[model samples]
Target: MFPLFLWTALLGSAALEGPESRLLCTSPDLSISYSFCGGISHMLSLGVKSCLTKDNTKDDLYLFFVPKRDIIELSVAIQVWFKAVQVAKFTEPLCRGFDDEYSFCGVLKGETINITVPFSYRKFIFPQGQYTVLFEGISGRSNDLIFCVNATVILK
Candidate 1:
């Protein structure tokens, strides 16, 4: 059950510089402006999704997601870089993480959900390349867009 707030670090700006400090998806100063993110498509506000910050930083994460419609159910997908292209990796429920303050089972429209909580990430190594993740939600009733966003990250 992947939460919505966990994978949003890729939504951070793309101007990140330097080697160790350049790409900071988990930085509290992270911004949602897609213009900053090279691979992000579509516009989003803030509500759900989880992110795994750099394993060394045991900092509190400020959760944010933007949803622009009344949600009936969630339809989510994940993609990663492959052969110099982005490919679908996973498709699953991303709203299960919003148990306390927000939930997909409920209805929301043109609003944002914000929360701050301390988080820890398991130590793991990523391949040297670019990885992309995408997610979205659609209303089953009216077939309108609820939320949609994607991000790409490069590791050297």
Candidate 2:
């Protein structure tokens, strides 16, 4: 019958393909682990989850948070491989809502916001290794600690 013929074709093609023909690939189930660095855990939650992308070459970070206080300016320190480095420090303005790149910029205090940040590793040929990143934030005006997130990423 035609039904049996169609089924054979479908199964035959699927078995022929390899991992490179991945239709849907995802990382292992992961949880947001606690870090020794300080953070406003009362209102922020961070996690790493595999998200589908066009190229299927990168992973993303998911953040759901509510700000406890008004934030105008932000300072960030990103440490790779769990080591401190001066070059990884930077400062940027918060709440640039007009820019489409930051759709969650206009969030108000007590309002919940969820956003995804992607890590694309295809452009640069990264060496095979286990990499971990630590992101620490401080309030620009008060110079007080706000949040710290540490995550490990594996690249193949």
Candidate 3:
């Protein structure tokens, strides 16, 4: 559960828009739900079935989803991989401070978790290549995996 103060701060922002496309994961952990928003219009979607459409607008990407209701003790992690090479890793603490134009202020709405990735963020810059984003919800007590999302994105 998030503190009341944090929740209030997050909800102060405008509600997130939807995504233009959905990137499907190979075998998503069903305990959690995910959403993605991007482009200038901030189109939103429940999930990405494949690669996102090519866009050079350098718009920010928003990730929002709900976690399991029963799990109050867990930490989240975001990882970026390019051609199987890990390029970036974000822990919960790091994400909390990554609120510049390059990232979102980690926010919680009800059971939903929200995060943003600004185009100016170094990790979002692809060298005219493809990449994968992994979002994980991990158990805090036993250090076990709770939920995971693997989405592919291409930069052109």
Question: Highest lDDT, which number?
Answer: 2
Candidate 3: worst-modelled 10 consecutive residues by lDDT: 25-34
lDDT of 1 by residue, 1-156 (tens): 243333343323223311222223433423222221222123333321333445443556454554565554555545554444445567665444246344434546645556565654345455655565444455555555455444445544
Computed on alpha carbons, the lDDT of every model, listed in order, comes to: 0.44, 0.52, 0.45
TM-score of 3: 0.41
Q: Who is ahead in TM-score, 1 or 2?
A: 2
Per-prediction TM-score to the true structure, in the order listed: 0.49, 0.55, 0.41
Error of 1 at 23 (Å): 8.1
Candidate number achieving the greatest TM-score relative to the actual structure:
2
Candidate 2 has its poorest 10 consecutive residues by lDDT at: 16-25
For residues 19-130, write the lDDT of model 3, one tens digit per residue. 3234333222112223332222232224332323333233355555554332435567887766645688886722223332322223332355555555433343347556
True-structure lDDT of candidate 1: 0.44
